[model samples]
Target: MTKRIQHWLAMLVTTFMLTLSVSAVASNETSANSDNERLGESVVRQEITGFAGADYWRMVKDGQEGYTTSKSPEHGVLISVPGQTWYILKEKWMSPLGALAIFGSLAMVALAYVVVGPLKLSKPKTGRKIKRWSRFDRALHWSMAFTFLTLAFSGLTLVYGKHFIKPVVPTEVWGWIIYAAKQYHNYMGPIFGILLVAVLVKWWRKSLFTMVDIKWFMKMGGMVGKHKGTHPSAGFSNGGEKAIFWLLIFFGIAITISGLVLDFPIFDQTRRDMELSNLLHMFSALILICGFIFHIYIGLFGMEAALDGMITGEVDETWAKEHHDLWYNEVKDLPENQPGYDAAQEADKKGSASQNNA
Candidate 1:
């Protein structure tokens, strides 16, 4: 019985020893794996020409620094590769801010097509033609839109260019890619600046706040579901849309002006100033990107058939009738297309006849 008890104890001890040994081996394996990932080499900084943005490159040959040390090493050396870079994570989506800008904006865009004012309509509305956009207005819009698009793509490249892309592309190829993005980002900034100025100037008059605008806000611009009625609207601009326009204008000027200072070394900027501008540029741009998502939503989907006015400089008769009844009525009173039967021509003819009668 004593021998049997001793044998059982020996078996338990052996099992315990095996478990500890396996755990130790696993821990060492994990540590080794981490070490293997790092390029274990001494770094000797060397300057090289023909590298556009690279200030210095650490020399490595066959993954080792050739330099010899006579002294017995007590402290460990920091083994690093030549490249030091920040890349956006190549994950399912970007950060919360980035995802908001893309997804929220896109969702609004889809919803725009689905509904406009209300669920059911008591009456269909018509308006006189108010000029939707002027020639200069359009040119300004397109210029900024193009520049904004360019920035979006390049900015994305800066973020995600390193992670998913670097693996597939050789380092030499990726270096050029980054260099190109930087060059384009710099060159296009001035054009964006000009467009921002135009946006501020052209819309300043109408975009200003007024008492009527306050009231327009009070009633939420008569927007209802498909079934409800649309509220009375102003001639050219509605308060809600105009408010967004103003936000864009204000932020646009702020960002673009800041971008100018950052684009080149023109302004003798303090490190603090440069840092501030960098923050402003990135944060402001991020905000604008988010805001523009809604802007895009409204411009495309928020209003029914809104994009046509931008293209051919006119909207569908049905669309104008539905969305801008009051404005449509006012424009139809003009002389050019006044004589016809559609709401616009009828109003104009009536006005002309009235004047003739008078």
Candidate 2:
């Protein structure tokens, strides 16, 4: 009986060992299958999405250019990371600030007009005409004015037209308007550069700063505050005029350089170069636009008879003496300003008038 019981115990132990081994093998097999399934899913996802995952995107963000048939600069670049930064700066910061600057200038001019009115002459007119500008000077002045105004309008349209003009016009019309503005801006830019150079050459001597200019500035050109109507002493150009002239020369050069970079992209300019030029161009333009607003105000409404010289190439003797006393004194005794010359001119005019009457 003991032998039979020992045999049954041995069989039961063998059976238990086999069961445990089978169970362990089954668990391992299940885990291995799960891992294989996950690997397969990853492969499928990569194929479907056509993306090489994080490392590929990281390369793109680093401005890594891929192979392409085109040979143009940055043509192979899938994404320009720096371009994104430039776009954010222009759209988010520069655009709004530029608008504010332009409108603010207009507002200030309006306020000045209300508060101070025009800078009228302290004395009555002498009825004697003094040559303030020669015929060539007048021609150059008007030409520059026309070109400057045209560029300003087109540039403003390019930068801020959407806010004011786009909404009011039909879609087709707006498209035409923007296209025309772009063309006008492009063609007129070189012309403006030429005029800018001419102006610098013509006026650098007169625009030089002097000790008298310092005093004139301290008195705020004798047109504001306690000095209002004082008609401060000035040379051919006042301190304010000198400031404007220099500003135009420096900023105008910047504008011209940047504008050339934009207008002619044939110089192997990369995307980064264009982006930088665009930002510089807009910034320089905004400053000039603001400065010229005050200039225009001075010409049109800030000073009485200010526009007379530009229009007729002449100003009254009283106008010259009150505004540009130094220059007037220097030129007052010229052949044109002599009593005999005035009499001769009067006689010629009367003779012509009598001929017409006959």
Index of the highest-TM-score prediction: 2
Cα lDDT of model 2 by residue, 1-358, tens digit: 8999999999999999999999999999999999899989988888645567667767877989988999888898999989999999999999999999999999999999999888988889888888888888988888998998899999999988999999999999999999999999999999999999999999899999999999999999998899988888998889999999999999999999999999999999999999999999999999999999999999999998889999987788898999999999999998787654775678899899999999
User: Candidate 1: which stretches are off by over 4 Å?
Assistant: 1-101, 107-131, 163-173, 222-232, 339-358
Compute each candidate's TM-score over C-alphas: 0.59, 0.81
Model 1 alpha-carbon miss at residue 339, Å? 5.5
- Top-scoring candidate (lDDT): 2
